[model samples]
Target: MYTGMRISEICNLKMVDIDLENRRISVVGKGNIYRRIPLREDVVYMMKEYVEQEREKSKFADSEYLIVTQRSAKMDRTAMLTWFWRLSAELGFRIYPHKFRHTFCTRLIQLGVPILTVSKLVGHSSPQMTARYYVKIGMNEKLHAIHLL
Candidate 1:
């Protein structure tokens, strides 16, 4: 939810990819491209807690992956989807992993962050691509723009 990484990227994240001290995540994105995303302080603390307390107690605690499953050393896309599905059922809402990516981008754009910066942050090849696919100018934004004019 914090980092706008793809589901595959999140699933493939390794312990080495995260630098808690620096408050950034080194992501190997699509086409084997690399990008560094700054992390929020709260996110850093949560990640640290998850790693030191929860992940440490997992059966696959020695796994190099940041997230591991009891059945496997790494958590795959299927497992992630299943987890979201269960959460969705319990929460009485349709929640999916990709939705978080969309929300991340949308929230940044809504906050008036530049499209180019958001593009780089999300590892998009171009700002146009990011604007075309990710940026949703909602009715509220439209109303706001009209008021500004």
Candidate 2:
């Protein structure tokens, strides 16, 4: 939720990809491009705790992947989807992994982050691509724009 990483990127994340001491994560996005994302303090703390307490308890703790499945050492797309489906059912709402990426991009744009910066963070090839697809301008924003005129 914090990082605008694609579902595949998240699933493919390795322990080496994360630098908790440096507060950053390296992900390979589309086209096998690599990018480093800075982590917030809260996220870092949570990750630290998860790694130390929860992940360590798993039988697959030695897995190279940061996220491990109870049945397998590595988490794949199917496992991720199944998990999301169960969570959605339990919560009585549709929840998917990509929703986090979308929310991450939308929240950053809504917060007045530069389109170029948001685009880069989300791994879009261009700001125009991000603007065309993910930049949602709501009724409130339209009203605010008209008032500014």
Candidates' C-alpha lDDT:
0.93, 0.91
Q: Using alpha carbons, what is the TM-score of model 1? A: 0.92
Candidate 2 Cα deviation (angstroms), residue 20: 0.5
Tens digit per residue, CA lDDT, model 2, 1-149: 99999989988999999999999999989987678999999999998998898889999999999998888888899999999999999999999999998999888888889999988887888899999988777899899999999
What is the C-alpha lDDT profile of model 1 across 1-149, one tens digit per residue? 89999999998999999999999999989977789999999999999999999899899999999998888989999999999999999999999988989999999998999999999998988899999997777899799999997
Clashing pairs in 1: none
Off by over 4 Å in 2: none
Give the candidate number with the greatest lDDT: 1
TM-score of each: 0.92, 0.93
Worst 10 residues of 1 by lDDT: 133-142
* Backbone collision tally, model 2: 0
Best by TM-score: 2
- Identify the runs in model 1 with alpha carbons over 4 angstroms from their true place: 138-149
Please state the error at residue 28 of candidate 2 in Å.
0.9
Whole-model lDDT, candidate 2? 0.91
